[model samples]
Target: MAQHALVTGSSHGLGAHLAARLAADGWKVTGLGRRPASETPGTPGVDHLQADLSRPETLERITDRLGEAPDLIVHNAVSYPPRPAHELSLAELEDVFRVNALVPYRLTLDLLAATPDTRFTSIVVINSESMFHADRDSGAYAASKAALRVLTGSLADACRSRNTAVATLLLGPLADPDKVAQLQRVAARRGVDEAEITRVFLRKSNPDLVIEELIDFDACYRSVQYLAGLGRAANGMLCRLDGGSAGSLI
Candidate 1:
């Protein structure tokens, strides 16, 4: 039988791409997001579960929808609103934590409890480089991600007796159209080519890095796949798919 995978925040970005890629790789994929099922990524065998992670109540239906435990669970849902530390409101902080940390914790526990008979081989949490180095106006987002990273460690400890492996992926800025446009603007402002600007930024951030500057969606998918393939022997591990960004900082 093919392995089953559950991916949260599969409506767009890395989650959507990862879900589609897993489906194409012959894994039975279930995507959870707020968008309508039809709007999810194009994968013929994938099932889309519509839920808003910001609301804890919506997550109650996850176990009912799966009917069984999945082999791999990827927590990729996140709320990223750029605001300075002083400008962050209570509501905004709560919202970010709800989606980034609380929902993933609840869902992981729910699935683990619901699937007593089945073994969850791996749980992958999608994290950001900001968890280590917070950028300007990203205090709230960084704090939430840092919390998620800590949660990943705690979850890994809890799963040790059950032989379930947990992996946290720290990723850098992905190569997308919006990011490309932003890079272009920076390039124009610095009077340098986009490639040169990217190189300079990466070098300035971390001089020890030899990997590529930008991480793409496919890189994220492949990294998750590698984690899932590690079986139960891997245990708790922090895997960086950031193209050496984290290596430079720490």
Candidate 2:
């Protein structure tokens, strides 16, 4: 039988890219997102399940949507509110945490419960570098990611007995269009080009790093593929792919 994979937040960004890549790799991919599957950018073979993860009840029908248990589960859904620590309200914090941390926790539990006899080979959590390096005006996002990171550890421990590998991909700033636009705005404010700003960021973040400055969608997809292909020996490993910028912080 072909391997099946479930990827959350598959409407766009890294999640969409991973779903398409997995489909290209011959995995039966199911993409879960708030938007309809037709609206979500995915490969021809991917199955799209529209559900709001923040509402825990929406996940109850996930197993039915997916005909079989997933061999690989990638939690890539996230809520990012660019608010400073002092400006963050309780409601905003709760909203961010609900989507980023609580939803993933509940979804994973549901998956594990529904597939008690089936062994999942890999569970990849798409974490952020914000978990370690605190970016200005992103405290809420960072805090939620930190909670998810902790949850990843707990899930790994729980799945160890079943030989289910859990890998956390600590990613840096992805070169998505939104990120590029943000960089452009910052560059405009600093009276410099975006390229120069990126260069300075890379130099200041990790001067000794030898890899590329930014993490792109391709890099994330390859990392997930590698993590999902790991043998039992590499279970419960934290794979940092932040272009070596998280050197000392991690």
Query: Which residue runs does candidate 1 get wrong by more than 4 Å?
Result: 184-193, 201-212, 247-249
Clashing pairs in model 1?
none
TM-score for each predicted model, relative to the true structure: 0.88, 0.86
The digit string of per-residue lDDT tens for model 1 on 15-39 reads 8888999989999989888899778
lDDT for 96 (candidate 1): 92
Specify the poorest-scoring 10-residue window by lDDT in model 2: 205-214
Can you write out model 2's per-residue Cα lDDT over 35-68, one digit (the tens) per residue?
8867887578788889887675776777777877
Which runs of model 2 end up more than 4 angstroms from their true locations?
A: 116-118, 181-197, 201-212
Q: Estimate the TM-score for candidate 2.
A: 0.86
Q: Best by lDDT, which number?
A: 1
Model 1 — which ten-residue stretch has the worst lDDT? 205-214
